[model samples]
Target: MLVFILNAGSSSLKYQLMNPIIKKVFASGICERIGIDGVLKHEYSEDKELKLDIAMPTHKEAIEAVLSTLTSGEGKVIDSINDIEAIGHRAVHGGEEFSASILVNDRVIETMKKLIPLAPLHNPANILGMEICQELMPGKPNVAVFDTAFHQTMPDYAYMYALPYDQYTKHGIRKYGFHGTSHFFVSNEARQMLDRKHNTRIIVCHLGNGSSVSAVHDGKCIDTSMGLTPVQGLMMGTRSGDVGAGALQYMMHQENMTIEEALDIMNKKSGILGISGKSSDLREVLEGMQNGDERCRLAVDMVAYNIKKYVGSYVAALDGVDALCFTGGIGENAALIREKVCAGLDAMGLVLDPVKNNKRSKVARDIATNGSASRIFVIPTNEEYVIANDTFKVVTESR
Candidate 1:
């Protein structure tokens, strides 16, 4: 079946057209800077890449452009849009109503609207994409695979805050971790690579511009670092990870700053970028570290330290963890960070083979030393595939 998966942002639309039955990505690309000078980049697996300069004033325009690309002779992956069996979307938040992917319907659309306050930056955009597709493909089936759904399994104790109980019950104000889709995909893939069953305990580290760690026990999320919002986890490229609750109040009082002002600092001007006073990109941090920049070295060390601390915390949460899997841009590509994080884990019976760890961009492989009790792996995440699979399941099951 031809499944088109979309991940819509405030000003961008990334899409993948895939024949899920054959597991082949026919065409994939993104439209960037919508409502401004736009860029359309499309790629076909047959070594064909197209870059177009166009005016995509809205997501509707972007969708129309994408449809044109699919039917065009230059990059035609299929005969017509009718060949698309279904459309899947990466909905960033589902509030408390959706626990899994669901076929798009009027009720789903309404629920998505109600979720806007919970995800002001994402849900509105997602709704826009959905509405555009509904107009463009009248009766076509569309699915919303939420990023928050996979984390719904978190128990009350794990997701709750110390705030007044009524706040949570009234406003749905509990932890709803982000990147659930990526964490879910990588955890499942890691289990398969380990030749183990779903019930095995695993810690999936999803590190990138945005990052989080999940503890999967019995194939369900037991705990995750992110809470209520994406800004609560391990230090991200721009977001300050976890911080003392009192700091916000103190900063506001001392500087006469508003909550929004403090939030702007926490969300945009923090993490490695804030500490290093350099670039947020890991590659740039590494370069500065190699050039003997103490601040850059400190930034790198801090990120690694935060990851290791989470690993230890997950171990305790699970009582004992079976595997530690790394996935995402930094997790899959940063060998230096991996080496540093695994340095003192030997006390926890987790050891890495330096030789194996040194190999860059290797696929899922065991990197643990001979005598380690736990295994460590590097598994790249495929959230798009997860959305596709969920979309296929929902559509087919309904039929």
Candidate 2:
């Protein structure tokens, strides 16, 4: 079956057309600047790419342009929209309502609407994409693949915050981890690479602009670093992670700022950006560090240190880890970051081979010393494939 996977942001839409069984993406592209001047980049194959600047005043127009590009005569990927058997959407926050991918229906849409407060930055766009797809393709199956679903397996103790019981029960405020889809994909890939049984314990560090760590036991998430929101875990591109509540209150009072203004600072003006007073991109930070910038050096050190701290804590939580997997943008490409994270982890049985760590490859490969007890691997993540596969399964089972 051909699955069209979509990840819709507030102003952009990323799409991939793929067949889950063959693990092949027939076409992929992104629509950028949906509300203003728009650009649609369509890549049908490795050598064939088309960039078009068009007017996309809304998501519906963006979707229409994408469909036109896919079916256009000169560079067509499909003859008709009918070629797409199902649509898979990436929903950021499922809360506790969705534990797995499910077919989208009226009830699902309503529930997702009710969840808008939980994912103010994501769910509305996701719902808009789904609603547009339903209008354009009336009878085709649409599936919701949530980013929070995989972390739903986390134990209550691990997910609950230290807030009052009434706050949790009445306000639905608790640690709901993000990046669950990426963690799930990478951990399963690690299991395949290690040839391990179902119960193999693995700690997956998904490092990117947005980062999180998960301890997977027997293919289920036991604990994760991200809590309540994506901003609670690792220091990210622009987010201040794990700031003390008292500090926040003091800052708000000192600046005579409201709660929303303080939160805006924490969410958008902090992390590496606030520390280094530089670009949020890790590449830029690394370049600055190499040029003897103290703040950049400190930023890099802090990121690695934060990741290493989480690794140690997760190791203790899991009792012992069988394999440690690294994924996401920073995890897969930033060898220096990986090396720094594993530098002092020798006592935890993770010994990184410097030579292997330096040699980067697209495929999964171990970077651990030959005799290390905990094998270390670098596995790239494929969230689109996971969404497509889940969509196919849900659609097929429903039929």
Candidate 3:
């Protein structure tokens, strides 16, 4: 089935028109700066793409532009927009309400609205995209594949914070891990590489600008690095992961800043950017490190150390790991980062082969050597594929 996958951010909307069954992308692009001046970048084929400056004041106009381009211009991939069978919207926070992907309807929309407080930066845009799609293509099937859905299997003890019980009951405050789809996809792929064994312990390190690690036991997520939000786990590009509450409070008092101001710093000014006092992009940090910048080197060490600590804790949580998999942009490309994460874990059965780790490949490949106790792999994540496949399944079954 041809599925349209939509992931709407605050000012950007990304989408892919693809066939879920065949694992083929018909076309894909992103609409940038929705509330400001708009730019539509459409990739119609492997070698051809079009970037046009357009005026899109809202998500509605963005979708319209996408549909118009897809059927009538240089970006055309299909005869008509109607050829797209289903729409899959990436909902960021389900907040304990949805454990699986479901066809979008009034109730699902309302539930997502209630979850906005949990994911203020994500759910609103997601809902806007879904509502706009529904309005544009009336009666068309829309499925919401939530980022939090796959982590719902986490036990209450694993997700609950040690705050007042009423805080959770009345305010819905808890550790709702993000990046569930990526964790689920990569872990399952790692399992398949491990001969489709049962009772397998897999640790997935999804290292990107925003990173997270998950402990998947027997194909289910038992624990993850991210907690409550994307900023709670491993050090990310800008997010200050797992900082002490008292430290933030003390800094706020010293600086006489508002709660929002302090949180903004943690979310947007910390991590590699805050530490190195350099660019947020990891590539830039690496460049500075090679040039003998101590701050940049420190930033690299901090990120690697945080990820290593999380991996160790999750290994204990899963008792023992059978496979350790890396995915996402940084995890897939940064050989130095991967080597640092697994540098001293030979006893834990994660012996990294420098040759295999450095070589680039599009397909899944293992980096652990023959003498290693467990397997270590670099598996590229496919959250869009999961979204498209789920949308196809729900829509097909509904009929």
lDDT of 1: 0.90
lDDT of 3 at 248: 94
- Clash counts for the predictions, in order: 1, 2, 0
Estimate the lDDT of model 2. Answer: 0.92
lDDT of 1 by residue, 103-168 (tens): 999999999999898888999999888889989998889999999999999999999999999999
Candidate 2 accuracy as TM-score? 0.99
RMSD of 2: 0.9
The TM-score of predicted model 3 comes to: 0.99
Write model 2 residue lDDT over 202-268, tens digit each, in one string: 9999998888999999889999988877889889888988899999999999999999899899889
**Backbone clashes counted, model 2:** 2
Where does model 2 exceed 4 Å of error? none
Error of 3 at 341 (Å): 0.5
Candidate 2 clashes between residue pairs 3 or more apart in a chain or in different chains:
175-228, 176-228
